[model samples]
Target: MSYAVTARAALFTLATALTLSPPAQAAVSADCTESSITLPPGALYPNGIARAADGTLYVGLITSGNVLRKRPGKAWETFFPGADTVFASNALRLDERRGLLWGNSPDFLSGGKARANRIYALNVADGTLNRSLALPAGEMGNDIVLGADGTVYVTETRGGGILRLRPGETAFSTLYRDPQLAAPSGLGAAGIVLLDDRLMAVANFGTGKLYTLSYNDPKPQLTEMQLPRLIENPDGMGLAPDGALIVLENGILSGQGRILRIPSPKAAGMHQLEVLREGMESPVNLTITPQGCAFVSESRIRHRLLPGHETEVPDSFRLYQLPLPLTAAQ
Candidate 1:
């Protein structure tokens, strides 16, 4: 090859690297001072976040939006492209054992008006949409999590409670249903970590409480715990490495959303937990890295949907990285 060809090739390689490198890693990871959620083509209120085994972050851009995936130390990538193919309620979970992601099909936004509001699965390796699961009565399925045994548990908020779907079973059965659960939006299950075995937790945005239930044996009991403060719209949930639960509260009434931490996830019968950060704007989605860095996705849509008058969110998409001290808290 000539010198000119080699020079052009070198320049092309450098450009590629720059595009893939994280904004902070460009010079320093700590240099990430500007926090923003870069919305994809159709992501207005993008929700649902899951981290793969390889540290890649997969987010649900619900309301017929694309599923956005961001590999660690890199910019976001649009692996799947289909409007509302991934539904509402930010239901996205990386099935660690099965190596697939389960997302909800809840319809809350205007874009998701015609959606079926079901559950779908995708292979992490190829981003191919595989294994679609429909909801029962399809009462707008929302958040979901997988048990250690590969059993898929989802929160059917509009349907009133949690639904459990075992492996190879297409249908589901009601695990817990109560009027106390106003809106069971986000869910996380502790299989091996909790002594109660299938320790499932759900976030109720309407009530601002984190309700936990245990499947010790034949019967399951439901318990509700209020939030530290009046956090509006507690949307997505992510479990930190140190076993603490990280909640992304969308402050709709207060016009703010914040990342809150609840220590002692296994400990039950608690009134409320604590909030680590405050004054966030519509933080709808959250994902925890292996290193315990909490990445929150903020969408200022709530501020726009005001009474009589309305405007689109003009803020750039943001993802804040918070170094949570979960281990030290423990």
Candidate 2:
């Protein structure tokens, strides 16, 4: 099947499952203690999560384009109401310095009628739409990472490349493109994190491969990183406090979602991949706090992706918090 056909099929299946399913309240996992927060009622498929410095959280929903916000001890509020223009919010990153919250809002979840993808910048203070950039037709904006020099980089899941929006630029330009970045399963780059000014780590959701992009030179270099073992659908990624790579494996199809910590990803052969936690329910994205806790958004996509498992759809999704000890740096 062609990439477009396969993608449409997968999306159609998910939509059918969701239509057949009825939401029910489910118990939290034993590992999810007081730190985990339940998503607001009626929120489904929480795909992206970003944390503010003041103990506030911003979450983007996949089915609805709504961006929800939660303060330290306050009820959840709709930061950005969902609209037809902003269809699905996949990944989010908070640019606190610039007072913007960047997110990828694709139309894939809008009944599989894929249209132009969108990357939006919202005012962090009041959740007003600051700017919205439309990607070319047939491109799916999946994940986002902001550069130190005010550049915005987004992963094209269907286009199998990276798109860049430089400072003072009105439109995005192709930063890098390669056929190998995509998998036969139709999904391509899903997660990305800036290592420094020039380096970025990206995860391939369909192939479960990891790669590093060096964009210092005129021609950017994309090098696949050899891993200790095959990762099961790597989804979202972030940098730890001590500069280690922290990855979330969605494992929605395999039913083995987990989080991993790679102490030295550049030197993969020398360092072992530590499994921090396992058995999560389709964790799609994560954001690390300054105090060393990782907050993961459990998307629970399996309930909507698997036909027979639709009844398992939970009434409320959750955000899990796992403390990463400083000793993990070693």
lDDT of each: 0.58, 0.75
Candidate 1 per-residue lDDT, tens place, 176-293, comes to 7767554333222211112236666666655555667775447877776544344345566777766677777666656656676666656745433456567876677666666666
lDDT of 2 at 161: 89
Model 1 per-residue lDDT at 183: 34
Please provide, for model 2 over 60-84, each residue's C-alpha lDDT reduced to its tens digit, 9 standing for 90 to 100. 9877789999988899999999666
Which stretches of model 2 miss by more than 4 angstroms? 1-34, 268-271, 310-312, 328-330
Let me know the TM-score candidate 1 reaches against the reference structure: 0.76
Worst 10 residues of 1 by lDDT: 1-10
The residue pairs in collision within model 2 are none
After the best TM-score superposition of candidate 1, give how far the Cα of residue 103 lies from its true spot, in angstroms: 1.1
Ten contiguous residues with the weakest lDDT in model 2: 12-21
In model 2, what is the error at residue 170, expressed in angstroms?
0.9
